[model samples]
Target: MAKIDIRRPHSLSVADARSIVDRVAERMREKFGTDSQWSGDTLTFQRSGVKGAIAVVPGEVHVTAELGMLLSPLKGTIEDEIGRKLDEHFA
Candidate 1:
């Protein structure tokens, strides 16, 4: 399996950051067919070829995931897309 780990720093309040992450989750569900749940300040999501968590802290959001073999080859593309979304949402 391949892994993706990205940490992005933001200036928004915790609640606002989490709300944006939830928005990202909804987009993920629509585009990738994944489901997500929140546990404390972290949101975890899983689908057949991907499993990941997005954690929100005081000044950062951390994203981590493992891609299954079938999806591993596309890691760069996937990571880029995540980065793009992060930029779009949090920039």
Candidate 2:
């Protein structure tokens, strides 16, 4: 599996961060056929093709994504899509 991580510093409160993560996770789940859940500062996702978690701490948000071996050939596309979504959310 290939792991991709994105880190951003934001001024959002814990609750707001959680909400954003939850929303983003849901969107990702629907679009990518993944399972996602949020717990406090962490949002985790698992699917046959990929798995990962997003961790939010204080003023920082970290997104980590792992692509399965079967999907390794599309790693660049996957990473680019994730980066785009993160940019949309943080912007």
Candidate 3:
């Protein structure tokens, strides 16, 4: 498996950050067949070839994921998309 980790600073309140995360989860479900759930301020998600968590805090968001072998080659693309969305929502 390939590992992906990303951390970005943001100015959003925890509530707003969570709203952004909810949108992300919906997008992931539509685009990637992922399922997600929130545990406190963290969102945990998984799909056939991916598993991850996004943690929301007062001034930052952290994301971590593992890509299964068949999907590992697309790690950079996946990470870049996440980065783009992060910037779109939080930057």
Candidate 4:
């Protein structure tokens, strides 16, 4: 198994930050068949081989995920993709 954890700081308003996350989540849902839900300030997501939460707080977005055995080898690539997305959307 592999774990990914990322934290990015942003200056956008809470609503705006969440909207960005939602947009990202929508794309993930379409491409990966991920199912997600929001609980307070966190968006939780899961698919066959991955599960994670994106927590949007006052000035930070923290993403954490665990990958199953089949997907473990792609951890670095996945982390880079998340970083790129965070940079694209939150930077």
Give residue 4's error in model 2 in angstroms.
1.1
lDDT (Cα, tens digit) per residue for candidate 4, span 8-68: 9999988999999999999999999999999998999999999999999989999999999
Runs in model 4 lying further than 4 Å from the true structure: none
> What tens-digit string does per-residue lDDT give for candidate 1 at 1-91?
9999998888999999999999989988998899999999999999999999999999988999999999999999999999988887778
List, residue by residue over 1-91, the lDDT tens digit for candidate 3: 9999999999989999999899989988998798899999999999898899999999999999999999899999989988998998889
TM of each candidate vs. truth: 0.96, 0.85, 0.96, 0.98
Q: How high is the CA lDDT of each candidate model?
A: 0.94, 0.80, 0.94, 0.96
User: What CA RMSD would candidate 2 show?
Assistant: 1.5
Q: In lDDT terms, how accurate is model 2?
A: 0.80
CA shift at 1, candidate 2, in angstroms?
1.8
Q: Which model is ahead, 1 or 4, in terms of lDDT?
A: 4
- RMSD vs true structure, all candidates: 0.7, 1.5, 0.8, 0.5
User: In candidate 2, what are the lDDT values of residues 1-91, reduced to their tens digit?
Assistant: 7778888777888678778888877776787788887676788889897888899898878888788798888988877887787677765
How far off is residue 67 in model 1, in Å?
0.2
